[model samples]
Target: MTNIAPPLVLTVAGSDSGGGAGIQADLKTMLAHGVHGMSVIAAVTAQNSRGVQGYWELPPEAVRAQLDSVLSDIGVHAVKTGMLASTALVETVAEVLAGAGAPVVVDPVGVSKHGDALLEPSAVDAVRTALLPVATVATPNLWEVEQLTGVKVVDEAGMREAAEAVKALGPRWALIKGGHLPGEPADLLFDGTREYRFTAPRHDNRHTHGTGCTLASAIASNLALGADVPDAVARAKEYVTGAIAAGFPLGTGIGPVDHGWRQRAALDQSRS
Candidate 1:
């Protein structure tokens, strides 16, 4: 058999002990895209379906060491970032990611599904100044948009305004997730010169714990496979839409979007 290696993608994020989000979700999403996934754990969270109990970030030097170990050897085709809990961690991760040749997908993860703060308020400015500038694409949900850009996204028009605000912060592209909006879930992507909007039927499932992390990682995987920014977002939109539909309850609280839902379906059909 020919030894063929898959496209490699890296997720620089926190670890979710619950296995629903963070580094776990990112790696699962990457595998669903048929790419190799690597991780640099910036923090560790004691979380479950109900909520995040507590978290601790690794030292800046430790973070830098892990990043260097990965990028210098196993080298990634694309990168994705999530949950740098504090300002110093954010700055450290930003400095490390600033020079990587791969495209970077920055997910401004603010809180967990159960409303626990993941990134500190003080880190918001660091994300805007040090991190967003290095992003090939920045993914921010409505609440995060408000947090980072101070833009109140009240309606579709507000979504556009938020995208512009995020673009102004220096990312090459902005993906303003309007999933919190009423009716259907939609996301708007803008790159100054052009824009793309993606909408999916709102699934009634409440198990959407890792949707943001999964979507951002999927985009990184697609980018690693050589898709352009807009196309990568579109493909990720489709994947996450299906994952949302397939979401199932895990623990007492909101569960997770099924990363292997497609494969699970196929297996079920075969057995049937």
Candidate 2:
């Protein structure tokens, strides 16, 4: 007899040497949700808690070949994309996923945790036109929301408008993360007719390095496991909140949230 799972998630993103965000964070978030995760590296970044120093975007053929290899065998239940550095890479990935027929979570990553540019200006239109239209949900930070749609989000109120602007791009849903705003950390999800707000008390800790990647990956995992978009967003928000509260200090600069904080708790409970 064989026991097999029903769903799997694919992350098409970049490698973060720092392990705080990008591909590393996506995989960690998937595992934390009890889902199998696979990745296609689109770029390699020299990064740390402080910032990104350098990056190299992989060739489009290499990116497509990786995606094809994964899809031909292992197969995917859902897909999430982040840090596609160039217009060409974005087009290639869009073409591949367009036929993959899996629910996709597109995180239009514009800047890093330390405010470094991750996406090229030339890629913005490609991302909006090619990638987002095929997405089940488009997750963008406030900065990204502005860059992609010219929608400025200064508060929770502005998130709705930003989400609508992003939804106009063709995604079924848009999650505009409001953690960058002053006050509590809140996220807004809009799907044309309805809106949902996910709010949590802002943790004072300065170690939130991978929150965006983590949230989007978590949502993708849930979707792969058959949860609907709103439910997925709600659960991802809760998980990230816990991770933030349990974040650990790493390098001398900003640090990463604890992706396996739940595992640590379970271990402590067993010992007790």
Q: Name model 1 segments beyond 4 Å from true.
A: none
Itemize residue pairs with steric clashes in candidate 1: none
Q: What does candidate 1's lDDT look like per residue over 51-138, in tens digits?
A: 9999999999999999999999888899999999999989988898888989999999999889899988888899999999999999
Candidate 2: list runs displaced more than 4 Å. Answer: none
lDDT of 1 at 203: 84
lDDT of 2 by residue, 140-194 (tens): 9888888999989877778878989999999999988998898878888999999
In order, the Cα lDDT scores of the candidates are: 0.93, 0.93
Q: Among these predicted structures, which one has the highest lDDT?
A: 1
TM-score of each: 0.98, 0.98
